[model samples]
Structure formats: structure tokens, C-alpha cells
Target: MTTADVRTVLTDGDLTVVGQIVHASNATLVCDAQVGDTVVRCVYKPVRGERPLWDFPEGTLAGREVASYLISEALGWDVVPLTVLRDGPYGPGMVQRWIDTVDPAESAAERLDLVDLCPAGSVAQGWLPVLRARDLDGDQVVLVHADDPRLQRMAVLDVVLNNADRKGGHVLEGLDGNVYGVDHGICLHQHDKLRTVLWGWSGEPVDPVLLADLDKLLRRFDGGFAEELHEHITGAEVRALQRRIGALLEHPVMPHPRGDRRIPWPAF
Candidate 1:
């Protein structure tokens, strides 16, 4: 059966739900979930009837699945796996393997300085994010003082280039006090979908490993590997992806926004 069909069995079996569309405008079914004894989290087009799924970007879920497999193999990132199945309750939806870790919210609530997702400026190592703000549990989650001059900057440029499917909550604080990026279902897009708050290192020197990864990406793009994805992505998107790789290589020095780095509303 298609992945969509499996979600049905999951929800019907009575799983513990954790997440929901924070905005009502997004009635789409999503949950930081638990199935049987397995912790699972996923989002999908809500279905109707005894087994009806509502509207969602059809195959968008599937495409993310494809993207996850590729990046996890290349980067060893903890990309979650999802299956678009018939939600027995929510109807048609995607079922995913849940991550077992505390989120930034729980971390902050418990006064735990788990993983420092601060900006990269003058300290530490590893893939720490720069800007992390969440509205978890109706109490806005904020920990680090925004003005920490020593914190490393966020890597919004890398995120955008990756076309990451980074919902605010998908990023996690592992028990090991390290930040683990999850939910890469919508990444490595062929388009220039660079939208993130990690801009602290915008104009800084590129990390050797990150640069190496991008170079590898370019080789794959020009090779038959990218061809395998043509059926799944748009031509413009492919070009946009190439453009990002080339641009980052050429000019990896763009300053962070003068003030708030938030993308403008109604960007249409």
C-alpha cells in the first residue's frame, strides 16, 4: 500500500498526540506523536469520511520523504521518515517516526541550557542555530539574551539553500545537550527557498565542512543524480538550487538584516 494508507492504521490504534497547527488557518493534522510505544510526529493533509483526508500539497509529503533519504545519507543528519497514509482518525495523513528528546520549550521551562542555538560569532563548535524562537504551549519560549555578542550567528543562508522543511518545532534539544535538526522533508529543493532567521554569519567565512558539502552538492546537481529528481522538482527550482550553490561559492558574505531579519509580510 502507498504510504498514505498506513497512517490510518496508526491513528486508529490510538496514539498520543503532542503537536497541532498553532494557527487555525492550518487545520491540517500534525502531531508530535506516539504510536504504540514508538514516539512519532508528522503533518499531512487531513482527510474526511470514515477514511477521508482533507487538502494538503499532494506528494509534497512524498517529496520530502525523498529529500530526507538523500540528505540523511550525505550528512548523517537525523532526518525523520514519513509515510502518507490514510489517517484512521484524521483520514489521509503522513505518519512519521517520532524523535525522542526535549524541545527548546521544555528545555527552557526546566531552566535547562541544553543545546545552545545561539548565533555564531566568537565561540564554540557544532551546528548550533543562531535564532530560535517558539510559541510552544502558549508561552513564548525564549532563553538566550538576544544581545549575546559572543554567540555564533545563525546560518539562515545554509538553511535556505538546503530548502529545509524546518517547522519551528522540528528542531530539537537532545538529551546529550546538543541540538539536532530534524524534519528535512522539504529540503534540497531545486528552488531558491532560503527563508530562516539564522543570519548572524551571513557575511562571514564559510565553514570548510559546509563548503565541502555544497561542493559535493554541485557535483551531484550536474550529474545524473540530480536527473533522478527532475521528475520530482521544477526546472526553475533546479536552476535556483544551482544558483545558490554557485552564489554561495562566489559571494558568501552578505550581512545580516540591519534590524529585524524577519521576512516581510505579503511577500507577493
Candidate 2:
């Protein structure tokens, strides 16, 4: 289906819970939402199912997820999938289009190499080593990935949104060759809470394309983005988002991990 059709189905569809994601910390369900004649598979997170966070308030993760989508859309980056906050079988929560992921073993095998096996410059052509560690056998190994442009864009998105839970699993590569970010529940806070697993571009120059997108976002907020955002998040959080954009605009480079705990645990 076309993207517009998907958006319509996601925004104004008959949501039906098909199953539950048992591993999720919150109440997450798999749903088949009907829009006109089409049914779109969606991941639904209900507020009533939310587990309270120490830093963030209770039952507010759902709104944060939707707010992340709005900010992503405003930046003109398809970082997050089509998402919305609506009443469902359990209660009000965030519902997003589910992306079918490319097998990680397949995707990683093509881009990664064993540090001990590959020649010095053999893997450096377009691949960047991201992880160096010991495998289960206690052998030194390194993991590399293609310098994918989409992953770079997603890194920028995470920075702008102040995403706090950008786990490796959150970065999904679809069969259609598009990379999407999901599960942005504790984001856009008024503090410097940008924890993520996408620091491969750390210390590199920010591409002009990404800078331009940030500029566009600034203009949009100056126009009406802040006003619209207030519906989903607090006024303070909206200001925090603007502050993040301004910081990125001034830096114009990929940020390095600050302090000792900038990145998330279990980087994979």
C-alpha cells in the first residue's frame, strides 16, 4: 500500500488486538487495524499497560512515542514509522506501523568482518568497525558495518529527539532497504538525555543534508511546530527539543559520548 494509505489506516482505523508482545516491559500488543478495505499491522502500546519510570512520569511514555513521531515528521526524516495516539481495546496509547526487519545475521554478515581475519584496508573501503570484543570462544573479534546513510540520518534524529532508549534492536532494516527507528518512549526531555547505540559517526562532520534538515526543523518550530507539539508533550519538553536543535545547529558535527554513561547497555 502507498504511504498515504498507510497513514490513513494508522490514523483512522478500526484497531483490533491480535496478540501481545510478551517480552515488552509495558503492555504491548500486535494489532491488525482496518482502514477502509486494507488492514495494516501495527504495534500498540497502551498507557494502562505502562510501567512507571523513575525519571519520567507514569503513563506518559505513550505520548512521548507519538511526540517523537511528530518531531521526526517535522524534521522531514522518516526516522520513526507512522504513529499516532488513540483509544484502543485497553486504553489510550501509541500505535505505530510495524516494520518487518531484515535478518540481522544476513545484514551483519555482509557488512561485518572478523578483525583478525580481514586485511588492514580490506574492510576499510566502506565499512566502519563499530564493535571489538571477544566471542563466546574468548577469541578477539571485531564487528563492522557499512556506512549506511540511513543509519546516519537515524543518529541525527536520535540526537534531535534526545532519545533515551536507542537500542540496537530499535534500529530496524526493512526488506525494502529502509531503516526505521522505533520505541521512542522516554525522549525529548528537558535535559541532556541522549542515550543511543548509534555513535559510529562520532567526531565526524555532520553532512550538509542533515544540517539542512535541522535548519528546516528550526524554521518549522518558529512557524507552528511548537504549538502543535504542546498537544502531546509538556511546554517544557517542547522547549527542550528546540534547545537540542539549536545545540546541533551550533555544533554541526557528530557528538561524542560524554561522561562515562552516554551509550546504552549491551550495545547490541
Quote the RMSD, in angstroms, for model 2. Answer: 3.3
lDDT of 2 by residue, 72-143 (tens): 887788889989998888878899998987565766564542112233334566666655656677767554
Best by TM-score: 2
The digit string of per-residue lDDT tens for model 1 on 1-268 reads: 2434444444444544555655422244556444455434555434231121232233454444444444444443333333434443554544554335755564455342423333334334333344544443454333232222212212432453353333334445446443444444455565334444344455577666556766676777666756755544556655666777677767655445444524222111
Q: TM-score each candidate.
A: 0.53, 0.88
**CA error at residue 93 for candidate 1, angstroms:** 5.3
lDDT of each: 0.45, 0.81
